[model samples]
Target chain A: MKVKFLCIIALSAILFACNTPVTESEKNGSEQSRKSESEDSTHVPLATEKKVELKREGIFMFYVGAFEAKKMDTKKNPMLENKINIALDSISGDVIYGHSVVAGNIRPFQGTFNLKDGMYTVVAKEPGDNKYDGVFTFTLSPDNGTLNGVWTSNDKKLAVSERSYDLKKTEFKYDPSLELDGTYSEVYNSYNAKTEQHEQITDDAGKLNASQVELTSKDVENMYRRDLEIMRNAIYARHGYSFKNREMRYFFDTQVAWYIPVSTDVTAELTDLEKKNIELIKRYEKHAESYYDVYGR
Target chain B: MMLGLSTLKNKRKYSLLVLLSVYTYFLWLMIRITLQYFPAHDDVAFLSIKQDYVGMWHYKLAFFIHVFSAIFVLLAGYTQFSESLRKKNPKMHRRLGWFYVIVTLFFAGPSGLIIGIYANGGTSSQIAFCLLAFLWMLFTLMAVIQAMRRQMSSHRAWMIRSFALALSAITLRAWKYILVALFHPKPMDVYQIVAWLGWTLNLVVAEIIIIKKIRS
Candidate 1:
């Protein structure tokens, strides 16, 4: 009985050793599929053990310059430009898994796509739990480079009920040297009921390259709270991080031209320099006196 | 003559009431600001960014010492400066004066120097804070020494100077609000400017009062 048990353990250990390479090969196969989608080549299956060819299975980003309203409305303006990332988990069948990031809200969407007359017609719907959830009806070019769509709200009573989006395919690449340019003045949103004035920040706020350079206290000490916030978020923006903070979303979605909201989590993508800068910037942000009403010095 | 004397006394009483009211209101504001550190979390309020120093036991000790003791000295100003208090209750006046002097020289002043060395707005603000702490101790020391020597007028002038620096705690925040409202400069830029302006402006006014009112 002891000899049989020892033999069984040895066989299982050998099997586990063989199983490790299969998982590693599966990861390489997924990575190859991602490359194949961009390279427009036949998906190369890493191992004969796995037979399925990779289809459209990676996240695709589209830049929607403006969500133009169909009808003119005085109360609500739905014409803001933004980016949406559609994660196509599977495309071989009618079912699709994806999510769209808009103004910091990530809403999961399920849809269908069909090719006819060299144009792919697509229909997708967000979950009905949220009032803002809507139907996306769009057409993709033959090459899947551009997407044109119209969104109709689930709730008709919303100020702007229908809007159209003409989306240009955007590629996201992480670059550490990118900097936020120009000056912007906007009314900061806070719980303080008294502050209604627009706080203006200087171009000096944009000069520091937080990702590439190790920031010192002198470099960021003079920065306003808003500037520090922008500086820190710019690091994440470079990695295609989709911001959940409303202020960051508004700033990146509206002002930053290079920003593409591709993923909700970008922790693994952060370099050591970037991670350090984030910690430093966050410390300054926490101590920033200007973020709130001028109370604590 | 009696009517004139009574009216003058009434006028002094009224002015003291006004001063106390204003002081009480500012004290209330300071108290509210201080309450942010009640339970003493490592990263709260001003200490949030000072994570570098929060780990050090001495820095933490010094910070709380300065924060907790400075307010008592500020309160002591009311009794120490009041002529009626001094004349009517000399013993109470002396006690409060000693309280203010001792706290400033030993606790508030030294701790202020320690924290000021690590002040946030860089070396310029650090210099401003360190100088302010040193001057605070110096003035308080001189005030006590003058009182011991029975040089009442000299002691009064030094006390005025000491209190002006002490009041920087309040004026610095006030300047922060004003500068921020007028020009939305960077937070630390405002801090560096107000580091000097907070006390210097008060000292300037104090000097004017000393040369014109007290010296005359």
Candidate 2:
């Protein structure tokens, strides 16, 4: 009986936890950060530039030399060359590849180059179309190998204009990494991943806890009975049963009267009908007493 | 001569079974047609009939219960009448019988009750369908209890009534089709009349069979 009660509590807790609102601190902090970032001009500069060298080899492949840009722009001046490589190969039917240019109609060039220790700007522009331009600002190391500081752009047309990161030898750490909170948009996109992870964790925990609780077969049977009762109440609501006291009494009686016990143990103990009847009796007595105690006739 | 007479009786019985089987098959086809073709909601036939009765959840619950119960009833009725099947597969027959009873009790009976109370065309139709669902559940429950008690004859009689109620789902549609075809009455009027007549005729036929079987 205790184990059955615990199981009910556990199940209810899990459900409540899933539906609980995100903590106020988390929401407030994130909102404040967003507001501060939007207000801070230095965090994201208006424009920057960098030099990029391009080398063309195969039909679609090009070896892009190291280049720098103030801010990486994905839209007008796409720095990702793989996209350009793919688009070129698709159009020309050759396995051509390049470093900075992304495959497709919209291609942006991007690369990394050493610069003297100082604040610098990097820019990418289409040959003749001034419409597409990307720039970024960063401070170079005295050794001419390290590019440290913030990358920002003024162009709103670019998909990705600004990012803050520290770059050393071969490592990069980008700050203000995006995380999906449990909002509608995030939930829709992350549903499959979140649900799968939840299920795996819950199943494992449930198994271990079941053993710790030492729930007898009878306890599990009672838990199922309770689940059925809840299901029947939902059904009753669906059937438009008035929420009056008498109707509720009848609904409770009917549900409790029909609940059958499920046996998970190997021992063949009670016959099906006996088990069913016992469950019904137990449910009836429990629910009836509680209802009267709470509602008073 | 006796052997020939018995053989003839068997042949007649088999022919009746065949006819019932065909009728059931056609009934299922009609139900399938209605589900597939009928608009999800009708302004005239559904909404204008009654104010208290119209809602999305009501319609959805009604449709789901109607379809689900009809399928179970079809399975149960088919097994009940199949002689070769019953003879060769008694276990399957028993299992299907229990399934039919439980499903009718839990899903069909309650949903039907709710739908019946809100039935359009007036009080008479409401009473008719309410009684139909109540009797359907009552007979099935009795059959189950009796079977549990090992009262085979009583169980059989109750089962026959329960199945007759199940068959009303099919007959109701058939009656609707015929009414629309012949008189072309407004859909609401036809529904009201068919709701009562369908179950009434089903019970009447079942009573006759029960009387004859008892006498024999």
Candidate 3:
């Protein structure tokens, strides 16, 4: 009876974990447009609002490199590289409104667009709800199609108060053919605390494409924990899903060159094959016994 | 002379107590490992890859029977091998010995054989497990027959062999941990190697012990 009760609790937990609310994308789209339409007529007009409307609207991903202040030790605070995507959802005249997607968090930003002497410059400020919120001052060069500039954090006391970025205009499209390449061979993240070691994933992980093929136990039964994890996340990375897991973010942002941070939740974007493969991979992942020079069954 | 014999007996008893304590600790660890399968989820631990077999009713039944019975056989087998218990309470020793033999022959061995056919790591591990289950049942049966025939020495030898095969449960996991820690082999590669090594090494030790006894 006790075992049965424990089973109920365990089964309930598994059920809860598996339960992802199927969001109606159509409903969300209509609701968003309705909200925006209601706030359209505010009776506030700027000088250049009608004259200079920025035609460039989409996701511009910036490769940000943050460094410590000169007085601080460079060795201790190395140049931290990360990618943030600026999504220009609405552009009306001189005022451009959008959200910045970075490190699995979305911050709504609004700023002014100015075109002076054939060089387009923009100053965007993120909503100061977060401590790490900052202002992005950047320029888009028509010749190179790149957005380059510096981001100054609202909190000056932060170790990395300022970061510079060079962004390229990239469009996100789900390509099922995308597979884990050789760049993902070395894991820069995922430290094994018990063993004090990091994983060097084998090439076997690259052999099978979780997004393309339906996986069988024979295919994944022998894979290491890190290998399985990489294979599983490769599906998400392909969909431009910003990972909340720090280890996943570090791995994807640094290694996967094509990965674009777009949305924190991409459940609705997952293909049926990808969903099945995810379930299969997760089953194996839970069972995968990673070696760390520690006692295990 | 009596005092000297008593002291030597006490020393042997102390050593036996130490050995039993160590065995008990390992048994506790094994129990914890077994509990991970309880309220048995299809994707639990080793069952992760055995989804193909886990779906089959016979395979599921056999797996649970083998897992649940193996623990008792392990605990009961230890008591049967206790020299002081055998000497002082032969009746109790006989009962526990019969319990171990019956459980192994009727439940654990057959169920083990059933699951071994579908064992992971493909053909190599399957063959190893099947052979292990066969040998386990065979040795235990031989032990029972020898006891019935009053062949005390041979019964003890056969029981030693049978118990060693049973110890494969623990030794296999130990070898897996050691091998993976040192070599970092792939999961199935380690499984294939440990599947054979788990029992073969124990049988070799059992033979050594048996030969030492005969010589002594």
**Which candidate should be chosen as best, given DockQ against the real structure?**
3
Q: Candidate 1 on B1-216: residue-level lDDT in tens?
A: 999999998998688567666666566566656655666767776777677789999899999988888877777645666565578779977887888888999999999999999897888999999999999999989989999999998888888999999999989988888887777666777889999998998999877767775657
TM-score of 1: 0.76
Better of 2 and 3 by TM-score: 3
Give candidate 1 misplaced runs (Cα > 4 Å).
A1-66, A72-79, A86-100, A105-117, A123-130, A182-197, A214-216, A244-246, A265-276, A289-292, B1-9, B212-216
Expressed as tens digits, the lDDT of each residue in A1-297 for candidate 3 is 423433354345334423533221121111110011212122222234322333333223233322113222344442366667765555666776766666666677779988876666889887776777888888866456577787788887665677777777676788888777755355655468988977777787778999999999888888887788778888888887766565666677777778887666677788899899988877676656322233444
What's the lDDT of the predicted structure labeled candidate 3?
0.72
Q: List pairs with backbone clashes in candidate 1.
A: none
| Candidates ranked, most accurate by DockQ first | 3, 1, 2
lDDT of 2 by residue, A144-199 (tens): 43444433444555644554434332211211121112111111112355336211
Would candidate 1 be rated incorrect, acceptable, medium or high by CAPRI criteria? incorrect
CAPRI grade, predicted model 3: incorrect
Q: What tier of docking accuracy does candidate 2 attain?
A: incorrect
Write down the TM-score of every candidate: 0.76, 0.38, 0.82
lDDT of 2 by residue, B30-118 (tens): 34433432445442222322323445677557755654565556556545655566677688778878788778898888788877887
